[model samples]
Target: MRADVAFVNGAIWTGDPGRPWARSLCVTYGRVAALDDDRECAAAHETVDLGGRTVVPGFNDAHHHLALRGRRLATLDVGHAAAPTRDRLLGLVAHKARELAPDEWVRGGGFDQNRIGGFPTREELDAAGGGRPVLLSHVSEHIAVASTAALRAAGIADLRRPPDIPGGRIVLGADGAATGLLLENAKKWFDATLKPHRIDELVGFLDTASRTALAEGITSITDPGVGGLDGIGMGRADLHGYLTARERGSLGVRVTAMPYITTTHALAGLEPGVDGWGLDLGLRTGFGDEFLRLGAVKVLSDGSLIGRTSALHEPYCAHAPGEEPGRGMLAFDPERLAETLGLLHRSGWQLAVHAIGDRAVDLAVGHVEEAQRRHPRHDARHRIEHCGIASPEAVQRIARAGIVPVPQGRFLWELGDGFLDALGEQRSRSVYRMKSFLDAGVVLPGSSDTPVVDAHPMKGIHAMVNRRTAQGRLIGPQERLTVEQAVRAYTHGSAYAAGEEGIKGRIVPGLLADLAVLDADPFAVDPRDLADIAVVATVVGGRVVHGADALA
Candidate 1:
């Protein structure tokens, strides 16, 4: 009756209310078999001495972009650390241009105009590219700038007369010439430059992302978008890439991929009579097994808040020169959005609508409510991704509809200044509200939206508890969460959002044997030092996936 593997001499945060802590844990066949102080519990074929370290359930990032993060890791370095100034950013682009062939695109990402002083001008990029096309994505990934060469390469015959794009912007200068700043869906026009990755290339990206997640003690992730919709995902073959990665044993962490809603059209299997709004027959939400599964249909209902494109009720505090002031834009018209949500809901697919601004949130809330009224389904667990700015009334509606609000706490640390500038002081306080959602009796899942920021769960936990911006400014101090509450958000809260709470979130008996052993206890450390704590070892299903060398 001995366990298969045992961890001894450790402090385990079980995440279960009744039994909150344990001194030792035993795993049998990849499920937590027992948690006891008895030395007998340590009698297993293989027992690891934890050396009194602290253990918690492995983190589950509810809104990460796996393959995209890996791709960014391999791209040009222009983030705050890599290029902190305008000169550094342009210098990096220039250097990349020199290394590439004259015809190749000089690509870069993760540059923040807020920190790097300002967005690089199209003319400035033209010089850096030296006639080579260049495209540098803002850290938010919602906006990007392309060199003049790139516009021509993309077949734009007239810079001043670019095709009219709804739900996107092609910035025009005072002279009425294109400014090269592409916002929201406008980036899709340069698909030739941003080519879709091959299945093998996608698997490679997944491999890189998996290693990074394991190192961060993240055992499960819900990638918000895949299947190349609106130029956000990898490609149409993205699901195949994930499956190949899993079959090849390259993906070490569990993934619940939310395929783009429109991707269903491009996919095979459309019955002549049946609606084509969902996956093939018998494949809906919760389709696959533990390693890889379909979670929800990702619908990009609005743009990025930091990018100043999210639909808002009030005008933005700041504006670009020569630009008229206005509230942000929605990706879909209200009628179109309602129709889409209704179709998906009736088809038994959970909807993860990305609504950032209060204006967009209102539409999303109303859509979900109306969908349920028309065709009610219990425990549907529809999610509102990045419900960034929810008023008290909106929060109440969210709770009443049993919607999960997936907000990234790391945004406070990475994009807080941009948010402050965009929404001003009063409205900024309501952005990314954590405590208020909890107060309204709603589950708030923690996420990083990585590649936009750091993916470490500790960074998210620290940001949630501190609410401090990168400039040392604190916003919404009253909305700050306790350290324990923050930790739970990354653990049980995220698992609950993905409907995996019964299996993986807690370290209780019969739950998956997934744990993250840390060098220091998050509960015992200073709130400011949460991000500094290192993961000593990471275990997935009783097998050490990261830091095995240190444990050995």
Candidate 2:
């Protein structure tokens, strides 16, 4: 076959076991024709010399929020780096509030109360915002603090009778008033009442995010939670936003959309436990082409580990000196979870359940066990997102069941310290244990729960390899992975999570021609230097989609 594009003088990690390295490759019909094959069949094939650059399969983030992350990119940067301390965070937010009109929404996010000692109170926010309806989300997205004006705007005029949401909490002050902090499902009240973004408006943000992902050499992403609104106010259409971006000629990367099945009635009549899903669109898991498709049904089984909302088998260490220890609450009954999961499994849908704490992980595994016995479907490939706090027995079950764990490798770098503090030494020794998973024959795919941490695959790889926290403390020396193992998770591991390993993930003949050209070889570089390695170019579908002559 004639080649549409040919590459030579390159060091390519093919991700194939047999043909691991390739000096040259050819692409035709948006698929790899051959690796290191010499042929003169084409008279007009385009050839490019890679100048000894390293090529790897384009990264596929197994779990991330697409449009929502794009929206966060447009919002205020109240992250730890920006604020550093409580006073600085308040000042930054107040400064932003002063610029916006009082009637306008003054939304900000990425503020970590743990860094600032404790959650910011309503009075503190009120003093800074000058009557603006300011809201600052926690780094984990499981918690947030709102100004009094914002609380009123969100229909929370009284904390005394706050909305009774399942698996969520409204933090109240000693004065019997709302403290302005909302946790878990309580955050959804604000999310449901938060202002809505039109399809085009959301597309703008999605486009920006897509471009950013491509520039970073991320050719594909699985948005795990679409149609799951996390804000107050109703009518979220982020799933449609992807369609809008693709239709408007703005989509820059491949996307795998997973519609969240929630009881929030987030999507019209598509609530959890509901039948006749995708009847109108006529799509379910595995539907659509390579460009975009439905991958799994996302169901949150619990909250964040760092936020102390994730259900734990044992009581979590107290966050405050005097506060009682908490056994994190489960999001649903285990029996009901089994029934719902069985229905989805029998219906031929893939499952991506978020289970952070050990108990949540156990419940998620139990549900899968029940579902498998009820339906007995092979190759379900069910994924446990986070799968953070796994027990010894649960790890065995996960490996035996062959469930894919989509973990945030970046968490080892960013949240390892907090995890250590919360779980204590013995339990904390195994947080996000990559080595444990690999040792148990479990597939561990790398991902960043973006908006929670940096989404750079190299950064994630570095974390997995080093297990170094932000403060330069090595938390779990036992959980570290080798550079190659880490890279494999980011590429092939993620593809396995989405059932796209056959076409994508690997640079091999007959596979989709998705490659990322790096200026430095990851295999040869010092482990510490991985994150510093830059992506020189990105090619998808046999075409250079980013960098070099992409503009041409």
Each candidate's lDDT (Cα)?
0.87, 0.81
- Each prediction's TM-score versus the true structure: 0.96, 0.94
- State the lDDT of candidate 2 residue by residue for 258-367, as single tens digits: 87766222123344665533324435688888988987888878888888889888888876699787977776677776777777776677888999998899889988
Tell how far residue 293 is off in model 1, in angstroms: 0.2
Report the lDDT of model 2 for residue 150: 87
Per-residue CA lDDT of model 1 for 1-552, tens digit only, reads 888888888999988889999988888999899898465575787988788999999999999999989888878878989999999899999989999999988887998888876778899999998988898888878889999988887777799998888878889998999988988878755553466788888888899999999999999999988886465788878889999999898898999999887676422334555554676664778888888999998988888887788999988875678766578898878997798788788778899999999999999999999999998999988999989999989989999999999999999998998899888888998999999999999877889998899999998999999999999888888899998888899999999999888888889999999999998999989999999988889999999999988777
Worst 10 residues of 1 by lDDT: 265-274
